[model samples]
Structure formats: C-alpha cells, structure tokens
Target: MGVTGIGGFFFRARDPEALRAWYAEHLGVGSVPYGMWETQAGPCVFSPFPATSDYFAADRPWMLNLRVDDLDDLCARLEEAGIAATRDPEWDMPGVGRFARIHDPEGNPIELWQPEQPA
Candidate 1:
C-alpha cells in the first residue's frame, strides 16, 4: 500500500519547550506525546523546489506551508501579536490561492495559504 497523509512533522528547536509553546499559542499547532491536532480535510501540496529556487530563504533547508481559512484575518491577528506577516501581490494565483509569509522566533519560514473557494 502507498503512504497515507502526513502523520507528523518533526524538527529540531533551540528550545523545544518554548518553541512548542509558541506554536501552540500562535498557530494552534499541538505538541507531541499526546497533543495531536485534528486538521480539516483539504488539499495538501507535496512538492520539492529546485536547489537554486529563491521562493524562500537559501539558508533554510525547508519552508513550512500551512492551509488557512482566512488569510487576511490571520495576518491581522499575527500583526497584533507583534509578528510581522508579509504579503506580495505577485505570489497570488487567480485560481490557486493567496499567500502570506512569516518567520517564527527562531527564524523558520512559514507560508500561510488560503486557497480559492470552489464555486
């Protein structure tokens, strides 16, 4: 049988506890060891970019893209919390979705995507 959906995402953190708390507070990403988050069913993109691609920072090996319901409201909340979320008009696709970029405390790139609604 082929693989199913993504079960988990593991990564190293300078301070695991603090980072865990940050994620929980800001993005509602649950922690491990019994803190599994139930995400809504949606399209999940699984693709790799070229090594020389400038879509994200060169120093970071991978960028995390998260599906969101309301990009504008989320970006506003993030800004109110003192986290700067940047958006570029060029990044938007008419039929694909809208996008906003933000960096976590430890400097990890996070892309927030709000997909176009089906008519």
Candidate 2:
C-alpha cells in the first residue's frame, strides 16, 4: 500500500519545553511533547527544494509550511505578540495560495499558507 499522510514532524529544540509553550500560545499547536494533533483534512505539500534555494534561509536544513484558515488574522495576532510575520504580494498565486513567512525564537523558518478557496 502507498504511504499515508505525515505522522509527525520532529525537530531538535535547544529548549524543548519553552519552544513547546511558545508554539502552543502563539500558533495553537499541541503543547505536549509527542502528543497527537488532530488536523483538518486538506492538501499537504511535500516538496524538496534545491540545496541553494533562496526561498528560505540557507542556514536551516528544512522549512515548515503550515496550512492556515485565515492568514490576515493570524498575521495580526503574530504582530501583536511582537513576532514579525512578513508577507509579499508576489507570493500569492491565482490557484495555489497566499503565504507569509515567520521565524521561531530559535531562527527556524516557518511558512503560513492560506490556500485559495475552491470555485
């Protein structure tokens, strides 16, 4: 049988507890380590970028792209929390989605995407 969806995304955090708290408070992600997070059914993209790809930081090996329901509201909340969520109009596509970029406290790149609604 073919592989199912992504089961987990594990990464090393200098301060795992603090990072977990930050994600829980800001992004509503599960705070418990190794806990299951129920996600809505939607499209997920798994693409490997070139080693020299400038789309994300060169320092980091991987970037996390999360599907979001409301990009504007989430960006506003992030802004209020003093986290800079930068957006460029050029990143929006007719059928793909709108995107914004933000970094975690430890400098990991995260991309927030709001997919275009189906016609």
Q: Work out the TM-score per prediction.
A: 0.94, 0.95
User: Relative to the true structure, how large is the alpha-carbon lDDT of every model?
Assistant: 0.91, 0.91
Residue-wise C-alpha lDDT for candidate 1, range 1-119, written one tens digit per residue = 78768888888989888887888888888864345799888899988999999999999989999999999999999999999999999999999999999999999999999999988
Query: How many backbone overlaps does candidate 2 show?
Result: 0
Clashes of 1: 0
Candidate 1 clashing pairs, residues 3+ apart or interchain: none
Q: List the candidate 1 regions with Cα displacement exceeding 4 Å.
A: 32-35
CA RMSD (A), model 2: 1.1
Position 68, candidate 2: lDDT? 95
Q: What is the lDDT of residue 17 in candidate 2?
A: 83
Task: Report how far off residue 55 is in candidate 1 (Å).
Answer: 0.3
Each prediction's RMSD to truth: 1.4, 1.1
The reply for model 2, stretches above 4 Å from the true place, is: 33-35
